[model samples]
Target: MAARPIIRFPDPRLRQKAEPVVAFDAELRSLAKDLTEAMLAAPGIGITAPHIGVLRRLVVLRLESDAAAQAYLNPEIVWFSPETIRHVEGSVSMPGVNEEIERAARVRVRYQDLDGVEHEEEAEGLRAVCHQHEIDQLDGIFWIDRLSKLKRDRLIKKFEKLQRLGA
Candidate 1:
Protein backbone atom coordinates (compact mmCIF):
# COMPACT_ATOMS: atom_id res chain seq x y z
CA MET A 1 0.00 0.00 0.00
CA ALA A 2 1.16 3.52 -0.78
CA ALA A 3 0.46 6.75 1.01
CA ARG A 4 -1.57 9.10 -1.16
CA PRO A 5 -1.11 12.83 -0.90
CA ILE A 6 -3.95 14.67 0.80
CA ILE A 7 -5.69 17.50 -0.98
CA ARG A 8 -5.86 20.62 1.07
CA PHE A 9 -8.76 23.00 1.67
CA PRO A 10 -9.59 25.61 -1.05
CA ASP A 11 -9.01 22.89 -3.65
CA PRO A 12 -12.01 22.73 -5.97
CA ARG A 13 -12.04 18.91 -5.88
CA LEU A 14 -12.94 19.03 -2.22
CA ARG A 15 -16.25 20.70 -3.17
CA GLN A 16 -17.27 17.97 -5.54
CA LYS A 17 -19.59 15.21 -4.39
CA ALA A 18 -18.09 11.74 -4.43
CA GLU A 19 -19.39 8.87 -6.55
CA PRO A 20 -20.62 5.68 -4.95
CA VAL A 21 -18.78 2.43 -5.39
CA VAL A 22 -20.44 0.27 -8.02
CA ALA A 23 -18.52 -2.91 -7.27
CA PHE A 24 -16.23 -4.12 -4.58
CA ASP A 25 -13.49 -5.26 -6.92
CA ALA A 26 -9.75 -5.69 -6.43
CA GLU A 27 -9.04 -2.08 -7.35
CA LEU A 28 -11.45 -0.80 -4.72
CA ARG A 29 -9.94 -3.13 -2.15
CA SER A 30 -6.45 -1.91 -2.97
CA LEU A 31 -7.60 1.64 -2.76
CA ALA A 32 -8.85 0.93 0.74
CA LYS A 33 -5.42 -0.31 1.72
CA ASP A 34 -3.78 2.76 0.22
CA LEU A 35 -6.21 4.98 2.09
CA THR A 36 -5.30 3.31 5.34
CA GLU A 37 -1.64 3.87 4.63
CA ALA A 38 -2.31 7.49 3.73
CA MET A 39 -4.30 8.06 6.90
CA LEU A 40 -1.58 6.48 8.96
CA ALA A 41 1.07 8.59 7.23
CA ALA A 42 -0.97 11.65 8.01
CA PRO A 43 -1.17 10.33 11.58
CA GLY A 44 -4.89 10.98 11.49
CA ILE A 45 -7.72 8.88 12.86
CA GLY A 46 -9.88 9.05 9.74
CA ILE A 47 -9.68 9.86 6.03
CA THR A 48 -12.05 10.03 3.09
CA ALA A 49 -11.36 9.23 -0.57
CA PRO A 50 -11.92 12.83 -1.61
CA HIS A 51 -8.86 13.81 0.37
CA ILE A 52 -6.80 11.85 -2.12
CA GLY A 53 -8.70 13.03 -5.23
CA VAL A 54 -10.55 9.72 -5.70
CA LEU A 55 -13.98 11.37 -5.56
CA ARG A 56 -15.44 8.07 -4.45
CA ARG A 57 -17.68 7.36 -1.49
CA LEU A 58 -15.04 5.61 0.58
CA VAL A 59 -13.48 6.22 3.95
CA VAL A 60 -10.98 4.57 6.28
CA LEU A 61 -10.91 5.03 10.02
CA ARG A 62 -8.57 3.58 12.62
CA LEU A 63 -8.54 4.68 16.20
CA GLU A 64 -5.40 4.63 18.31
CA SER A 65 -6.36 1.35 19.90
CA ASP A 66 -7.53 -0.57 16.87
CA ALA A 67 -5.36 -3.39 15.56
CA ALA A 68 -7.14 -3.66 12.24
CA ALA A 69 -8.29 -0.78 10.05
CA GLN A 70 -11.94 -0.12 9.26
CA ALA A 71 -13.10 0.70 5.75
CA TYR A 72 -16.48 2.15 4.87
CA LEU A 73 -17.83 2.41 1.36
CA ASN A 74 -20.84 4.58 0.60
CA PRO A 75 -21.37 5.28 4.26
CA GLU A 76 -24.49 7.06 5.43
CA ILE A 77 -25.63 8.14 8.84
CA VAL A 78 -28.93 6.44 9.53
CA TRP A 79 -29.46 7.79 13.02
CA PHE A 80 -28.01 10.38 15.33
CA SER A 81 -28.65 11.21 18.94
CA PRO A 82 -30.25 14.48 20.02
CA GLU A 83 -27.54 15.00 22.57
CA THR A 84 -24.51 16.94 21.37
CA ILE A 85 -20.93 17.29 22.50
CA ARG A 86 -18.22 19.79 21.65
CA HIS A 87 -14.71 18.76 20.79
CA VAL A 88 -11.61 20.26 19.21
CA GLU A 89 -11.33 18.99 15.68
CA GLY A 90 -8.44 19.24 13.22
CA SER A 91 -7.79 18.05 9.70
CA VAL A 92 -4.66 16.96 7.91
CA SER A 93 -5.84 18.97 4.91
CA MET A 94 -6.04 22.10 7.06
CA PRO A 95 -2.87 21.53 8.97
CA GLY A 96 -1.86 23.43 12.09
CA VAL A 97 -5.29 24.59 13.03
CA ASN A 98 -7.99 23.07 15.19
CA GLU A 99 -11.42 24.37 16.08
CA GLU A 100 -14.07 23.33 18.52
CA ILE A 101 -17.35 22.15 17.05
CA GLU A 102 -20.52 20.59 18.36
CA ARG A 103 -21.58 17.24 16.97
CA ALA A 104 -24.03 14.48 17.75
CA ALA A 105 -22.77 12.38 20.61
CA ARG A 106 -23.81 9.13 18.95
CA VAL A 107 -24.66 7.91 15.48
CA ARG A 108 -25.73 4.78 13.67
CA VAL A 109 -23.99 4.35 10.30
CA ARG A 110 -24.60 1.97 7.44
CA TYR A 111 -22.01 1.16 4.83
CA GLN A 112 -20.55 -1.60 2.72
CA ASP A 113 -17.42 -3.35 3.84
CA LEU A 114 -14.42 -4.11 1.65
CA ASP A 115 -15.89 -7.48 0.77
CA GLY A 116 -19.21 -5.92 -0.30
CA VAL A 117 -21.07 -6.91 2.85
CA GLU A 118 -23.39 -4.26 4.23
CA HIS A 119 -23.30 -3.49 7.93
CA GLU A 120 -24.67 -0.97 10.35
CA GLU A 121 -22.73 0.09 13.41
CA GLU A 122 -23.38 2.47 16.27
CA ALA A 123 -20.59 4.78 17.33
CA GLU A 124 -19.99 7.30 20.07
CA GLY A 125 -17.35 9.76 21.26
CA LEU A 126 -14.29 10.01 19.01
CA ARG A 127 -15.53 7.22 16.78
CA ALA A 128 -18.79 9.05 16.15
CA VAL A 129 -16.94 12.27 15.43
CA CYS A 130 -14.65 10.53 12.97
CA HIS A 131 -17.61 9.01 11.14
CA GLN A 132 -19.36 12.36 10.91
CA HIS A 133 -16.22 14.04 9.63
CA GLU A 134 -15.66 11.43 6.92
CA ILE A 135 -19.34 11.55 5.93
CA ASP A 136 -19.00 15.35 5.55
CA GLN A 137 -16.15 14.82 3.12
CA LEU A 138 -18.32 12.49 1.05
CA ASP A 139 -20.89 15.31 0.90
CA GLY A 140 -18.27 17.90 -0.05
CA ILE A 141 -18.35 19.56 3.35
CA PHE A 142 -15.62 20.19 5.93
CA TRP A 143 -15.42 20.89 9.61
CA ILE A 144 -14.75 24.56 8.94
CA ASP A 145 -18.11 24.70 7.19
CA ARG A 146 -19.69 24.37 10.62
CA LEU A 147 -18.12 27.64 11.77
CA SER A 148 -19.72 31.05 11.42
CA LYS A 149 -19.15 32.95 8.21
CA LEU A 150 -16.90 35.48 9.94
CA LYS A 151 -14.80 32.83 11.57
CA ARG A 152 -14.53 30.81 8.42
CA ASP A 153 -13.46 33.80 6.41
CA ARG A 154 -10.81 34.70 8.95
CA LEU A 155 -9.39 31.21 8.86
CA ILE A 156 -9.27 31.21 5.07
CA LYS A 157 -7.41 34.44 5.12
CA LYS A 158 -4.97 33.13 7.67
CA PHE A 159 -4.29 29.96 5.69
CA GLU A 160 -4.02 31.93 2.48
CA LYS A 161 -1.35 34.14 3.98
CA LEU A 162 0.46 31.14 5.30
CA GLN A 163 0.47 29.62 1.87
CA ARG A 164 1.80 32.83 0.37
CA LEU A 165 4.70 32.81 2.83
CA GLY A 166 5.36 29.13 2.12
CA ALA A 167 4.80 28.30 5.74
Candidate 2:
Protein backbone atom coordinates (compact mmCIF):
# COMPACT_ATOMS: atom_id res chain seq x y z
CA MET A 1 0.00 0.00 0.00
CA ALA A 2 1.13 3.54 -0.65
CA ALA A 3 1.37 6.34 1.88
CA ARG A 4 -1.62 8.67 1.81
CA PRO A 5 -1.28 12.40 2.19
CA ILE A 6 -2.35 13.73 5.60
CA ILE A 7 -4.99 16.43 5.47
CA ARG A 8 -3.64 19.52 7.17
CA PHE A 9 -5.13 21.26 10.20
CA PRO A 10 -8.12 23.61 9.77
CA ASP A 11 -9.51 21.11 7.28
CA PRO A 12 -13.16 20.60 8.27
CA ARG A 13 -12.91 16.90 7.72
CA LEU A 14 -10.63 16.61 10.75
CA ARG A 15 -13.50 17.73 12.93
CA GLN A 16 -15.94 15.29 11.45
CA LYS A 17 -16.62 12.16 13.48
CA ALA A 18 -15.45 8.90 11.94
CA GLU A 19 -17.84 6.14 11.11
CA PRO A 20 -17.24 2.74 12.66
CA VAL A 21 -15.45 0.16 10.56
CA VAL A 22 -17.87 -2.74 10.09
CA ALA A 23 -16.28 -4.87 7.40
CA PHE A 24 -12.97 -6.52 8.09
CA ASP A 25 -12.29 -7.30 4.47
CA ALA A 26 -9.30 -6.85 2.24
CA GLU A 27 -10.18 -3.24 1.65
CA LEU A 28 -9.98 -2.57 5.39
CA ARG A 29 -6.65 -4.36 5.57
CA SER A 30 -5.38 -2.23 2.74
CA LEU A 31 -6.50 0.90 4.58
CA ALA A 32 -4.58 -0.19 7.64
CA LYS A 33 -1.51 -0.62 5.50
CA ASP A 34 -1.94 2.79 3.95
CA LEU A 35 -2.41 4.46 7.32
CA THR A 36 0.71 2.81 8.71
CA GLU A 37 2.79 3.89 5.77
CA ALA A 38 1.45 7.42 5.89
CA MET A 39 2.06 7.70 9.63
CA LEU A 40 5.58 6.34 9.43
CA ALA A 41 6.27 8.70 6.57
CA ALA A 42 5.02 11.58 8.68
CA PRO A 43 7.31 10.38 11.52
CA GLY A 44 4.29 10.39 13.79
CA ILE A 45 3.73 7.82 16.50
CA GLY A 46 0.02 7.49 15.77
CA ILE A 47 -2.48 8.37 13.07
CA THR A 48 -6.11 7.72 12.21
CA ALA A 49 -8.25 7.40 9.08
CA PRO A 50 -9.52 10.95 9.54
CA HIS A 51 -5.98 12.16 9.08
CA ILE A 52 -6.30 11.20 5.45
CA GLY A 53 -10.03 12.01 5.04
CA VAL A 54 -11.16 8.37 5.14
CA LEU A 55 -13.49 9.02 8.09
CA ARG A 56 -13.30 5.54 9.46
CA ARG A 57 -12.62 4.54 13.06
CA LEU A 58 -9.15 3.19 12.44
CA VAL A 59 -5.72 4.05 13.76
CA VAL A 60 -2.12 3.02 13.08
CA LEU A 61 0.54 3.53 15.69
CA ARG A 62 4.26 2.82 15.87
CA LEU A 63 6.18 3.77 18.96
CA GLU A 64 9.81 4.86 18.68
CA SER A 65 11.09 1.57 20.10
CA ASP A 66 8.64 -0.76 18.46
CA ALA A 67 9.75 -3.51 16.10
CA ALA A 68 6.36 -3.63 14.36
CA ALA A 69 3.33 -1.45 13.74
CA GLN A 70 -0.15 -1.86 15.24
CA ALA A 71 -3.53 -0.98 13.81
CA TYR A 72 -6.81 -0.70 15.65
CA LEU A 73 -10.20 -0.65 13.98
CA ASN A 74 -13.23 0.86 15.71
CA PRO A 75 -11.15 1.62 18.79
CA GLU A 76 -12.61 3.16 21.90
CA ILE A 77 -11.33 3.54 25.42
CA VAL A 78 -13.35 1.34 27.70
CA TRP A 79 -11.78 2.52 30.93
CA PHE A 80 -9.48 5.25 32.16
CA SER A 81 -7.37 5.51 35.27
CA PRO A 82 -7.95 8.26 37.78
CA GLU A 83 -4.26 9.02 37.70
CA THR A 84 -3.48 11.72 35.19
CA ILE A 85 -0.27 12.33 33.34
CA ARG A 86 0.82 15.15 31.12
CA HIS A 87 2.43 14.40 27.81
CA VAL A 88 3.30 16.70 24.99
CA GLU A 89 0.98 15.88 22.10
CA GLY A 90 0.79 16.90 18.46
CA SER A 91 -0.80 15.64 15.27
CA VAL A 92 0.45 14.85 11.78
CA SER A 93 -2.27 17.19 10.54
CA MET A 94 -0.88 19.97 12.73
CA PRO A 95 2.81 19.52 12.26
CA GLY A 96 5.72 21.60 13.68
CA VAL A 97 4.19 22.32 17.09
CA ASN A 98 3.13 20.47 20.22
CA GLU A 99 1.92 21.18 23.73
CA GLU A 100 1.60 19.41 27.03
CA ILE A 101 -1.79 17.78 27.47
CA GLU A 102 -2.99 15.93 30.54
CA ARG A 103 -4.79 12.65 30.12
CA ALA A 104 -5.47 9.43 31.94
CA ALA A 105 -2.21 7.71 32.74
CA ARG A 106 -3.64 4.31 31.94
CA VAL A 107 -6.47 3.03 29.81
CA ARG A 108 -8.10 -0.13 28.60
CA VAL A 109 -9.35 -0.02 25.06
CA ARG A 110 -11.80 -2.21 23.20
CA TYR A 111 -11.00 -2.44 19.54
CA GLN A 112 -10.97 -4.79 16.60
CA ASP A 113 -7.99 -6.04 14.66
CA LEU A 114 -7.80 -5.79 10.92
CA ASP A 115 -9.61 -9.12 10.82
CA GLY A 116 -12.49 -7.61 12.81
CA VAL A 117 -11.75 -9.74 15.84
CA GLU A 118 -12.64 -7.90 19.01
CA HIS A 119 -9.92 -7.44 21.60
CA GLU A 120 -9.24 -5.48 24.74
CA GLU A 121 -5.84 -4.29 25.88
CA GLU A 122 -4.44 -2.35 28.76
CA ALA A 123 -1.92 0.41 28.16
CA GLU A 124 0.11 2.81 30.25
CA GLY A 125 2.52 5.69 29.84
CA LEU A 126 3.13 6.79 26.27
CA ARG A 127 1.06 3.96 24.92
CA ALA A 128 -1.90 5.06 26.96
CA VAL A 129 -1.44 8.65 25.92
CA CYS A 130 -1.21 7.70 22.26
CA HIS A 131 -4.32 5.54 22.43
CA GLN A 132 -6.35 8.25 24.12
CA HIS A 133 -5.16 10.84 21.66
CA GLU A 134 -6.06 8.74 18.65
CA ILE A 135 -9.39 7.73 20.13
CA ASP A 136 -10.15 11.39 20.75
CA GLN A 137 -9.39 12.10 17.13
CA LEU A 138 -11.74 9.33 16.10
CA ASP A 139 -14.43 11.04 18.16
CA GLY A 140 -13.81 14.30 16.31
CA ILE A 141 -11.77 15.86 19.09
CA PHE A 142 -8.47 17.34 18.02
CA TRP A 143 -5.52 17.16 20.41
CA ILE A 144 -5.47 20.91 20.64
CA ASP A 145 -8.90 20.77 22.26
CA ARG A 146 -7.36 19.04 25.23
CA LEU A 147 -5.37 22.16 25.99
CA SER A 148 -6.60 25.22 27.85
CA LYS A 149 -8.31 27.83 25.74
CA LEU A 150 -5.36 30.18 26.04
CA LYS A 151 -2.94 27.45 25.06
CA ARG A 152 -5.08 26.30 22.18
CA ASP A 153 -5.42 29.83 20.86
CA ARG A 154 -1.70 30.44 21.17
CA LEU A 155 -0.80 27.17 19.46
CA ILE A 156 -3.29 27.75 16.64
CA LYS A 157 -1.70 31.15 16.09
CA LYS A 158 1.73 29.57 16.05
CA PHE A 159 0.60 26.81 13.76
CA GLU A 160 -0.94 29.28 11.32
CA LYS A 161 2.31 31.23 11.29
CA LEU A 162 4.18 28.04 10.46
CA GLN A 163 1.76 27.37 7.63
CA ARG A 164 2.21 30.87 6.32
CA LEU A 165 6.00 30.51 6.44
CA GLY A 166 5.84 27.11 4.72
CA ALA A 167 7.37 25.32 7.63
Best by TM-score: 2
lDDT of 2 by residue, 1-167 (tens): 55799999999988989999999899998888889889989989999999999999999889987898999999989999999999999999999999999999999999999888899999999999999999999999999988889999999999999999999
Give per-model TM-scores.
0.94, 0.97
Task: Report residue 74 deviation for candidate 1 (angstroms).
Answer: 0.8
RMSD in angstroms, candidate 1? 1.4
Candidate 1 residue lDDT tens string, 1-167:
35889989878888789999988999999898888888899878889998888999999999987898899999999999999998888777877667788899999999999888999999999899989988998998977998889888888888878778886
Worst 10 residues of 1 by lDDT: 90-99
Candidate 2: minimum summed lDDT over ten consecutive residues — where? 1-10
Check candidate 1 and list the clashing pairs. none
lDDT (Cα) of model 1: 0.89
Q: After superposition, how far is residue 161 of candidate 1 from its true place, in Å?
A: 3.2
